[model samples]
Target: MNKRKYEMTSRADAAARTADRIIDAMLARFATTPYENVRIEDVAADAGVTGQTLIRRFGSKAALMNATVARELARVAAAREEAAQASPTDTIHELIHHYERYGALILKTYSEAPLVAGLPALAARGRAFHVDWCRRAFPLDPSLSPTEKAVRTAQIIAICDATTWRILRFDGELDEAQTEQALAALLLPLLV
Candidate 1:
């Protein structure tokens, strides 16, 4: 007697689910561990798969990281897009919320950037996203000269940076509300 074969669609779905698990496992490890320190076998174990399975799914470590970055960037872009439609104060709160969730991981990646190839480019992409978001969220003074506008934009970028969030939330030990308030105090003034 011949055994029944699995459905192609079902197999595709199972593959997708496995990929999701691998990405989730990678992120979980990345939350606490540096990029260079993350091991294929460890991540595979976390995802309940073998290292070979991981390679079969993602091809390589860099490829896996690229996939992870794509997923994360999409998530962040969606959140920011929704927040952009809200008031500036609400936008700050949203940014604060984002930073609270992902700030540590962001810092970790930045700190480990030089050790990894393509990290600096990844960081630049992140910075470009932030700059674009800031420009949209806080438009510059139209009356200012081009140089002044550039300076103002830089100021906005600096204020909304993850490092600023680290200072207020982690170092200063501000609660979310207080963090929002502090950020607004500094940023809201520029909006006017």
Candidate 2:
């Protein structure tokens, strides 16, 4: 690359590193305190950066919170992918298992953060990701038309969210094997 382009890229990378540090600090604070009320100063202090630095990188607390939520959702997506790898016939079950393992923390973090109140957009991204996964995992669910398939894909994604997992696991206390069987049964209508 040209010198100017290289310099610009370097600067962008530096900014991203700063933002990551600030967000990491914010996440640490969030783990212990309510997200809605955390001041910028606290995040800056936790991150060992100046308050102005936080503002410079994230613009506002709301924006920073959104970034953190997006980061977490990406992690969730990766975990889902890893889980799906082990159970090729039942991607939905794998995703639900992933939720049982990790979804609650993300839900709690996002729900408690006012800045992450725009979660519908995040959900849309998640829905799209699930649709993509469905296209890959079950390309021929014969019962579904194209439109129906898309809708079903979205529903499966929502069903794998934290609430459903908690309902099945915590409320019902379904053992791991039982939960897997239940999810497989529950998914039969869509998958078969």
Candidate 3:
């Protein structure tokens, strides 16, 4: 019975590892490739698994994408929590680092939300994460009215958003350091 139980545990652990590999491969593909261009066979090849294995693990392409989004959100949440413990400037640096790493994936997910089955909820969750981060990173004045605080929060979200990062990094052709500087210049003033 003990040996049987050990084998069962090992199998479960291996299965979990395989699933994680699939999700990681999907995320890696998402970073450079557009959502529409990402094929399940390619993701499976990248993960060192069969296409059928991906389907068995995630049920469908949409489900795989959804799982990837869920995993990415969980990672972002943990990183945000750790960053929240630091000084505000340090936190901004962390945010910039995250944007530099994940901005393309975030932008692709948002743009494909309507066309993709499960991406709308992912996009909404991303927005919620940004809003919560802004609220925690920039505390409202006790003297301010609720409406004023809400407006300020909205402004902060806009300034620190993925779209803003995309515009600076891609459209403006700024490097990560320059983008971070631009963001800090715009946000630090409002935060104070």
Top lDDT: which candidate number?
3
Question: What is the per-residue lDDT of model 3 for residues 39-98, given as tens digits with 9 covering 90 to 100?
Answer: 999999999999999999999888998999999989988888788778778878898899
Clashes of each: 0, 0, 0
Q: Each prediction's Cα lDDT score?
A: 0.86, 0.71, 0.86
Compared with the true structure, what per-residue lDDT tens digits does model 2 show for residues 1-192? 999999999999987888888988877776667766789999998888999989988888878877876897788778666755654445766666676655566567646644465655775676577657655554447666889877776666555556666777778898767766666666656655
Which lDDT tens digits does candidate 1 get at residues 1-192? Answer: 233355766788899999999999988998888788899899999999999999998888777876776688778888988998899988998999999888888887778767766667877788789899999988867998899888778888998999999999889999989988999998887776
Q: Rank the candidates by lDDT, best first.
A: 3, 1, 2
Q: Clashing residue pairs, candidate 3?
A: none
By summed lDDT, the worst window of 10 consecutive residues in model 3 runs over 137-146
User: In the order shown, what is each candidate's alpha-carbon RMSD?
Assistant: 3.2, 4.3, 1.7
TM-score ranking from best candidate downward: 3, 1, 2
Select the stronger candidate by TM-score from 1 and 2: 1
